[model samples]
Each structure stands twice: as structure tokens, then as C-alpha cells.
Target: MVQDAASGDVVAAGTSGEKKPGFFARIVIFFRQVIAELRKVVTPTRSELLKFTAVVLGFVVVMMALVYGLDYLFSWVTTVVFGVPA
Candidate 1:
């Protein structure tokens, strides 16, 4: 017996006499909700798009450099431990 927090109304989980919507009715409801959500989307301007792209590319480049340095350091450590000739 769950109750709505705002309205203090008892939430009916298929217990009430009301019947759930049919398959097609649910499909219509789904599209309505999707359209409502799509309306909230904001398209970035050209300047904002360029800034976002530059930030993402800069982050990727920094990550690649970090990974390369770590790989080189680990390879050197492993070589020293196993006495592998480099």
C-alpha cells in the first residue's frame, strides 16, 4: 500500500477497478512522452560546439600521453625484474 508523497493518495498497483491501457494505447503514451522530452533538448551554437570539441580532443591527447608513459615505465620495470635484455 504505497501512498503518493505530495497528494497523500493511496497508490493503486493494479488493485483498483481501473484497467491498464491496451498495447496500442501504451505505444501512443510512449511517443507522447518521447516528444515531450525531445522538446527540452537545446542545440549548442557553433562557438559552443567548437569549444566542446577542443576540450574533448585535449583530454584524449593528455590521456594518450599518460598511457604511453605508464607503458614505457612498466616495460622498463619488468625488464629489470626478469633480467630480460633490452
Candidate 2:
């Protein structure tokens, strides 16, 4: 029984007691919503993009180093456990 504030009607959660629209109609509605949302996007500045890229790269490098260290540690442990000549 949740009512929309502006329309004062019970908004169906993707399903009301109504028949679904046809396939073409649904597609048109989806693209209309997409265009509407795309209009609201604000592009980041060049400096902001550069800073975000640098942070992402730094995080990836740190994760790579961590995984490499763990891999090396496990290899050493296996060698010692089985006494394999390495």
C-alpha cells in the first residue's frame, strides 16, 4: 500500500494488477529512461580523471604484489613440507 508522494497512487513494484506492455513498447520505454538518465550525468574534469586513474593503477599494483608474495610464500612452504629439491 505504498503510495507515491507526487501522484498519490500505489506504485507497483514492477508488477501491478495490469497486463504487461508489448515487447516493442517495453524496449522504447527502456531507451527513453536511459536517455533521460544519461542527460543527468556530469563529466569529470581532466584532473579528476587522471587522479582516479592513478589511484586505480596503484591499487592494482599493490594487489599484484600481495598475490605474488603469497604465491612465493606458499611455494616455499610446499618445498619445505615435501622436502622437494628446489
Candidate 3:
């Protein structure tokens, strides 16, 4: 729905019978939109990038340690129950 900004009335952008833009026109519009969006992007500083990378790596290491501990505990329990080690 399209709105009449000053009148505060809702309106359709186009009628159902109205033809849409052709393929080349659509491609041009797509690239225009992509460029507009890319213009809005902000790059992080080197320090901020380093901090983010370190935070991600630290999280991964903590997850690995937790998984290893749980796996070892389960393996020990299994060996005791089966009277055999893999």
C-alpha cells in the first residue's frame, strides 16, 4: 500500500493491470539499491576488529574444553558399565 503523506490516506502503488518495469529496468534498479546500501556500511577500526576476533576465538576454546570434559566423563562411565575400554 502507498500512503498519501499529506492527506494521511492509504493508496495502492499501482493498479493490478499496470505493467511492472521491464527486465533491464529491474536490473538497473537492483544495482542502484545495492550501491545505496553499500554506501551505508561502516568499517570497523583495527582495534575493534582484533577485539572481536579474540572474543570469538576465546568463546570457541571455552566450548571445546567443556565438550571434552563432558565426553571424558561419559567415556569413563561407559567403560565402568561395560567392563571394557574402546
Best by lDDT: 1
Clashing pairs in 2: none
User: Scored by Cα lDDT, where does model 2 land?
Assistant: 0.86
Candidate 3 residue 36 C-alpha distance from true site, Å: 1.3
Clashing pairs in 3: none
lDDT of 1: 0.88
- List candidate 3 stretches off by more than 4 Å: 1-18
**Where does candidate 1 stray beyond 4 Å?**
1-16
Q: What does candidate 1 score in Cα RMSD to the true structure?
A: 3.7
Query: How do the residues 1-86 of candidate 3 rate in per-residue lDDT, one tens digit apiece?
Result: 54566688876767434566789987998899899999999999999999999999999999999999999999999888897844
Indicate the residue-level lDDT of 12 in model 3. 79
Residue 42 error for model 3, in Å?
Answer: 0.7
Better of 1 and 3 by TM-score: 1
Error of 3 at 10 (Å): 9.7
lDDT, residue 7, candidate 2:
77
Model 2 deviation from the true structure expressed as Cα RMSD, one decimal place: 3.5
Candidate 3 minimal-lDDT segment of 10 residues: 11-20
